[model samples]
Target: MKKLTTALSLVAVMAISTQAATLEERVKALEEQNTVLTEEVLASQSAGFTLVDSEKTFNGMGPAASKVYFSDNPLSIGGYGEMFYANPDNGDDFADVYRFITYFGYKFNDWVVLNAEIEFEHGANADKGGEVVVEFLYLDFLLSNEFSLRAGHVLVPMGLINLRHEPTLFNTVQRPEIERQLIPSTWHENGVLAYGRFDDLGIEYTAGIVNALNVNNSKTTTPKTGWIRSGRLGSSKNASFEPAFVGRVDYTGVNGLIMGASAYYGEGSNLKNDDANDVDGLTTAMFDIHARYENGPLAAYGLYTQTTLDGAEKLSSNAAEKASGYYGNISYDLGGLLGVEYKMPVFAQYENYNPVEKTVDGQNEDAFETETVTIGFNFFPTKQTVIKVDYEMNDVNSQETNTLSVGLGFIF
Candidate 1:
């Protein structure tokens, strides 16, 4: 229980939605919350009951991303979605409706608030074709429990799947490719976020500035320096306000543990050439470290990431200024360690990525070095759904990419 509380029904559904609705009104508000919020599934479903979401957390954040910091009905809503299916041994198979997201919030009293998230991918068609986005929008201010204030379009807390990527709090169904390619999962921008907590040194923090990352798109590779996940500019309208600074710090003082570290610095040529800052001194820096553990029924995690860049050898010549990766995992539940009753978890993961780890003017793509291994299982018949099967082995560069997957994920 990562308890950091606040009242008012303790909103929490699970996040990223509400970019102004209209995907059939966000799938009719998640089919009317399966009959209005009573369908709540994020907390109780028995079996090793661990806090998932929809219980109430603000500093621990959850439920459509903190549900306006626990609003008391000044309006709050939530959403989540996932879908997957694959089969391959070189047979080329596919199935995906990949994502659907929703979230909206508002609270105007106890110190102003508003929130948003809306996404639809590979499944939405009408509003100008699949892949809609808006992943975050913000406004927050509360000056207690250690301070707070957030401003528009954030989500750059760095890692743990970029501010809790929902899906019942992780256990694989894709994610963790060194945090999706050198620390870039669901990376958002457009500035300002600040968080706080200390409470006798239990420690907690998050910092942000946002926007900044262009990484000179050399049309995608060959000196693009693997451009940090293709320089996710997120909202893109010829953006580049040039600002980027991210941060994180966590400790959770033992008991179920969480240890963290994160960092980012930026100036990756978002301005498309405003006098080259004198021929591209582009700029970038990244770092990461993580650990998590959940007691009972056993769970474990680990991560490490790195990136560095500067000018990228004047843009090509094989440009790569470094990149890195790491991953780890462990899971166990077996229905709360076998007293039976349901809920099973079994997992294994390993990763080592390199997206071009060191080059500054050519020669470094030994096929972009990679390795991955995943073994999984998760079954929850209730508790807001989960049924996933996984087996993956990848070794890129030396080729070989086996796959077999099945999935379903949910949160409400």
Candidate 2:
């Protein structure tokens, strides 16, 4: 809600600083702030939203999203940016500011908190066709580690990228296409969320009810045409009373490793299970499981997701029966293994997906099936910043294309 780039400029100084004393001073201030935050959070426990040392995120949420939960200071400002140069064999070469994002958090005492994300894409120029979007705005009422509540436009805990899309967290210059077209990263809706963790068993969970997707909009045939991404309400159209439920669970018993599975279920559009309406059991269901292992010099991760639409074929001309995709990556830190001065890891990723895996027979459709292989390396001048370069080979719906790119990403 606040255009605070200028304000961010003041805080940005700390990220770009090279002086040791400045870093030390910042750390000391951060520690003092934490001490105060803990005390206030504890004192406010009478309202049912306090936990000692609550600063730690039991669930795998991004650093920015979790900032307000335990901040002694009322406001927390941080951001990340990615700028890149891309050269495609089949297209022109260009350089662009791919993403500029800012995270703003405010703690209105311990029981209530506000978190938001403002995103600027492609340089944020109207002439150049750039745009800005309020990616997320949510409020959390912390009850305890075992139970808490969140409302407003909240992110769906469905895919890895949806929560941890910070560039440095992934290997390639771009996120996996499957996560984009299939799961639709950055997916959020008007809803309330319930999340908590059973720390004794290393189990974390979240359940929520949100506005259901508008798959049957008459103006756009996205639903009748079997397009999934366009169905997201996104706070644009009047959110239909039809609601969806999401549930997720994560197991983090092993140190430096996490495994999770989640599901989404809802009525497809406004279609009901009424035979008189000629649409029965037209429900949409999605399931996914993912795992990540990052310990020592080796890293490995993978995700598999699939969706099914019951009675969809009878409701839409281009409805799909099933859609699925999966991706995996493995990397090892050769620099560390070789005792090099800097840390660099060579990584490779493979993705296979079909946006419309199985559509209604006899209906015309674009499968949007694709496979990709990417090889890249990341160099860290500091723990918070990374320089990345990679080559991607795309098997686009059976066609071949190649691209090479280099970029920088930093978090503070």
Candidate 3:
């Protein structure tokens, strides 16, 4: 009886040892699986899907457009969209998808990156006068903190809106007429640029050569609209390619303040299919002085711009010899005053411009003068989205008109 009991005890010990070995193996397998899952989670977090920081911008670009500069992954995607409805006293009431833009960026390495913007306007339907276009596409060679190079289709660094054209960046539903008609806010061309910043000096500068404008593009230049805006060649397939010089400098020495000037000089008569004799020597020059200030809840920004046509008589009988304009905007954040989380800013803007300030035929400039007053408010539902409402009072050549506009804008 003693022997049988001992044998039973040994068997019981052997069974317990086997159970312990199996448990150890299972725990080791689980640890290996956990390690793999943890690695995957970390990778997903850094996969170019990070949130945007509105206050952060790189190389004077908008936050969304600068995503690649701050991205951890090799590929980045960002964009913005805006839609608006307008009711005009002397025109038709309409609602339209004004702009939808997408930014695609890829990092070839630590020093080289590719960035591009594709824009869809007015719903992108040809029958409805909508179209798709590439606003800018460039390769950035980041050489140092104070100097870099960019080549390909690039935005002409001229005014506030031209560099930062996102809807949320502006206070009005429509861009100021001065920026539109005088500086041409969305101006871009194929070129090579050199840009840099001096942190110690608090200065930023950009200088480059871009495709010259074709003053002869009749589709853009008209008697009522002026030839300044028509000079942008953009990225058309058959666009003429004459080199033009452009330069800009800005001072940010003081916190919450930016002051700058930009200039462009080019021969505008460089048409691809035009006769040399008919083109003549049409030289174009443009310049602007701009400033922006933000302190706590109060913000103000404005610019004064002028353009000159040296050989206006050669273009047409009614060609404008010179154009000039100015605009100012100020806003106070009610959200900050009320101590709320979201933002609500009320703004007022005033503009005076004359696209036809001087005509080759010596026409009266008073008949082309325009003035506008706009009052508006923007409500931010989130950091990346906003709702806007505004009323505009316009006087064009002493003819008065009024309009009410509502808009929705978002960025990501």
Give all TM-scores, in the order shown: 0.35, 0.80, 0.87
lDDT of model 1 at position 39: 34
Q: lDDT per prediction?
A: 0.75, 0.77, 0.88
Clashes of each: 10, 2, 0
Q: For residues 81-118, could you state the per-residue lDDT of candidate 1 as single tens digits?
A: 88988887988888887888877777778888888888
User: Which has the higher lDDT value, candidate number 1 or candidate number 2?
Assistant: 2
Candidate maximizing TM-score: 3
* Model 1 misplaced stretches (Cα beyond 4 Å): 1-64, 73-106, 109-137, 140-150, 156-167, 173-175, 186-188, 192-210, 214-267, 270-313, 321-341, 345-354, 357-362, 378-412
Q: Rank the candidates by TM-score, best first.
A: 3, 2, 1
Task: Report the lDDT of model 3 for residue 88.
Answer: 96
All candidates in order of lDDT, best leading: 3, 2, 1
lDDT of 3 at 136: 95
1 or 3, greater by lDDT: 3
Tell me how many residue pairs clash in candidate 1: 10
Model 3 clash pairs are: none
